[model samples]
Target: MAWYYVENNESVGPVQESDLHALSQQGKITAQTMVCRQGDTAWVPFAQAFAPGSAAVAVADPAGAPRVSHSCVMCQKSVTADDAVQLSGNWVCATCKPLYLQKLKEGATISGVRRYAGFWIRVGAKIIDSLILMMVTIPFQFIATALIPGANDPKAIGAVIALAVVTNGFNILSNLAYQVFFLGKYAATPGKMVCKIKVIRSNGAAVTYGRATGRYFAEILSGLTLGIGYLMVAFDEEKRGLHDRICDTRVIYKD
Candidate 1:
């Protein structure tokens, strides 16, 4: 029987069983290393694949049938061939197929696995960001109010309107700057950093300044949708919000 193992995130060649054991003894292969037999469509931990009486190995059934189990690449769960779908040479179980297809549609690099941030956690991060922005904008609000003339003075109406416009414009620019700076440079805002989540391109590349700015503006659509866009994260297979979908971005946990 021939076996393969994952090394440095790449699948290594098919070796004989004795060679696999030798590699294990040399510390080149560990129990947690993913391995699969040549005929198997699923990859499993080395320990599970070779453990005594492990079900991962094919066995002869009393009914003269072969019972072979495969592992889902997305969830790492054992499943029969009939229960899994092969995509891009990887086996994904039915439960993970929808999400996998979504990733594929978005051109996301589906290597190994990913843990996406859920709705409540994202909401918490948004709350933190809102509080921080409030702290920043409140002082500006006070200054703007003080600069405006009394409402009773009809002559000052034009000045008040001008002041209001300038203040609002400044607020918008500042907010845009904040988002663009953090997301472009670090791939996360302070709130997302606190939550241990980061935004990245669907292709698993780093976010650029232009993409970050566009994403900041795209959030307006999310807000305009009466928050249905935000709520989509709860039901989305990859936990993507409307802005994420529009910008082809994904929020995932840090390694």
Candidate 2:
């Protein structure tokens, strides 16, 4: 039977079974990307539809559903009648199996435990960090103003300008130091710590200060993209922003 797959929310297919397998092997199809056969009512994962002993190959009831409760280890979508595959002793839903298999094929071990931090959680962390930094910077500004309430005299004007420059410089250095130190040493700032997330490399190692600094600057690119770069964290499988992608890093929940 011919198979079809969803890509970017668009349906694509009617290709032969062999062609679908070829696409899976080629990494063109992921486990989480939905797919289905010609006779299937609901689209399933490409892996689920084609893996050995897949539910797609199973004899379903007259109603066309899985014969048992099978949950996908990745996406967690369950199906009663759709064919589910067993991989590494876990019932992987068709939607998540392809990616799992692909990871194995690529020599990447699947722990199946890394939980990516969603966008809202990251936003909450950012808000907390902003509040903390504001507490630090705001007082300095107030002191600068109190030092030279009215710049009526030349000395007062000079003092105010010098203080302004110093204030700005202090702000820059402190912010940089805050990120570089925490990310390098702890892989997270206080805010991220409060939110229970940390930054890590693709291999799950702590990021170096150099990488963290680079990621900090890459945040500028994310900002430059009209915030679309930051928004990418919402849709990405790895919960990566533009900066995270640039640095080959991911923000995930801490165990």
Candidate 3:
């Protein structure tokens, strides 16, 4: 039998069973080390492969390194080596370990390093979204205007004001609802979905409806700044506009 293990975030090859035992003896493999054999669908902990009675796998830190606790890079909780998980050279306590593992299972890195969306991609998505919004809102507007008997009559000024107010109010509320619903539920608007982009927190968690709504409003700041805030996406490394930064959200390319 041969086994492979993950080291420094890279998979190290299929060593023979004897080599596995040798590596175990050399303190190179630990209980937390992820191991897999040929034809295995997923990795397993080294300790699980050889249970206590079947065969004792020496997974202890035999190097004489102190058993003292270290702070978890994620939750900042103190954890001993036995309850700590190492990923990309950082220690994460058991309390925060499952989140990273789940991310890995979802094909995202534990550190949440994703290829961020650039300015032009985001702009195109916005354009598509705007067109969709127009398609939804414009028809109702035209119908309302046509149904009004004196819409173009000079003497019907009051009716014209009422219609304008109703149309603008409907547009505002509908747009708000559309944005909040999609961004919160799917982390992307229909247009963003088409563009293969999603909105996520810096930690790679889904953005809640409250945060999504706030992010939408914060976009006003981008316009208030004469579009400089929006253009920040072009210049910033993460391609975040001012609104994204203010809301602690990132727009990224989802695989």
Q: Largest lDDT belongs to which candidate?
A: 1
Off by over 4 Å in 2: 1-112, 147-164
lDDT of 1 by residue, 1-255 (tens): 888778877667679999999999999999977787765656777888889887785333312123356578778887656668877445789999999999979977676755688999888888887788878787877777676765335678887677778778878887898889999999998999999989998757899999999998888889899999989989888888999999999998786
Question: What's the lDDT for all of these models?
Answer: 0.80, 0.76, 0.78
Task: Tell me how many clashing residue pairs each candidate has.
Answer: 0, 8, 0
Q: Model 2: which ten-residue window has the lowest total lDDT?
A: 58-67
Which window of ten consecutive residues has the lowest lDDT sum in model 3? 58-67
User: For residues 65-139, could you state the per-residue lDDT of candidate 3 as single tens digits?
Assistant: 223455676666656555687664356777778886676589764443366899999999999999999997999
Give per-model CA RMSD: 13.3, 13.6, 13.2
Which sections of candidate 3 miss by over 4 Å?
1-112
Candidate 1 stretches greater than 4 Å from native: 1-112, 151-156
Residue 172 shift from truth in candidate 1, angstroms: 1.4
| Model 1 per-residue lDDT at 220 | 81
In model 1, residue pairs whose N, Cα or C atoms come closer than 3 Å (at least 3 residues apart or on different chains), thus clashing, are none
- Residue 190 displacement in candidate 1 (angstroms): 0.1
Better of 2 and 3 by TM-score: 3
